[model samples]
Target: MTYHHLTIDELTMIANFRDQGVKAYRATKLLHRSLETVYRVYRFLAAGHTLQEYYQHYRENKAHCGRKAIQLPTDEVTYTKAKVAQGWTPDTIMGGHSAVVCGRFTAFSSGAILICGPCR
Candidate 1:
């Protein structure tokens, strides 16, 4: 089955049903969602958080759920900038053939490295 994020109206409805002493199973039937999904929503509401707050927090958490960014060292960045300013190609700077420099150059060309300027 396809995944579907619950809307604010559905969350409010679940909260209201839970407040009226509805069980998780019944709420699942009412919302046509899984029991786990219904229970999760009920638990979020029971914790005294509003639907908007839950959604905001959910979005924040979702934003962080991805491949971590590559972190180039400050010294490496400085070295790259110095070399680029001296009219050295990224390939020459990294000793002719380096996968790291190649990848970094690709990322740089795509605006990841603003200080490098336009690579020659």
Candidate 2:
């Protein structure tokens, strides 16, 4: 099943139900969510966090939870720039090489290199 982030309304409902001393299972049934989801929401509310605060915290936490970004080494970046300036096509530079710096070439050809702080 596809995962769905809880809506603001759902979070409000969870807070309201918990304030009324309702059980987590009952809140789950009312919201058509899982018991764990209900409990997690309730816990956040019980910790004196506002709905917006909870949402912000969730967003901040999830922002860093994805795959780490790939960074090309400084030497490789210099070499790619020199090659491009020497009239070498991006395809030739990337061909038979394990280095994935071709994306930078495409960006350079499209005049994006100036806008990119690292590439510049």
Candidate 3:
């Protein structure tokens, strides 16, 4: 089954339901959400946090869940481009051909690194 995030309206309804002393299980039945999903929001509100705060905090957490952007130094990017223009393969560059210019870049495949570089 596909997963979906709850919208702000549903979040507010959950908060309103809890405010009226409605139990989480019953609220879940009405919202078509899992008991745990509704209950998590209930528990957060029960902890004295506002629904807006929960939404803001939820968005912040979701934004952080991904591969961080690759971070190579400017000199390394310049060096890689120059070497590639000179008919050099990425494998040769990664395999110590230009170790003096950039020993920091990792394994390269099809012009892209298998893992992001700048380990330090």
Local accuracy by lDDT, each model: 0.71, 0.71, 0.75
- Minimum summed lDDT over a 10-residue window in model 1 is located at 111-120
Alpha-carbon TM-score of each model against the true structure: 0.51, 0.62, 0.55
By TM-score, rank the candidates, best first: 2, 3, 1
lDDT of 3 at 51: 95
What stretches of model 2 exceed 4 Å from their correct place?
1-3, 16-23, 29-32, 99-120
Tens digit per residue, CA lDDT, model 2, 1-120:
667778778888888898899999988888899999888888888888788998898788767754443455676667667877888876776663466543644445565432222233
Residue lDDT tens for model 1, 34-60 = 899888888888888888888888777
Model 1 error, position 8 (Å): 5.2
**Weakest 10 consecutive residues of candidate 2 by summed lDDT:** 111-120
Tens digit of per-residue lDDT, candidate 3, span 1-120 = 766788899999999999999999899999999999999999999899999999999888878765564655666667777877888876666664454332434435324643354433
Among residues 3 or more apart in sequence or in different chains, the pairs in candidate 3 whose N, CA or C atoms overlap within 3 Å are none
Clashes of each: 0, 0, 0
- RMSD each, Å: 6.3, 5.5, 6.6
* Top lDDT prediction, candidate number: 3
Error of 2 at 114 (Å): 12
Q: By the TM-score metric, which is better: model 1 or model 2?
A: 2
Cα distance off (Å), candidate 2, residue 36: 1.5
lDDT of 3 at 106: 41
Candidate 3: where are CA atoms >4 Å away?
66-120
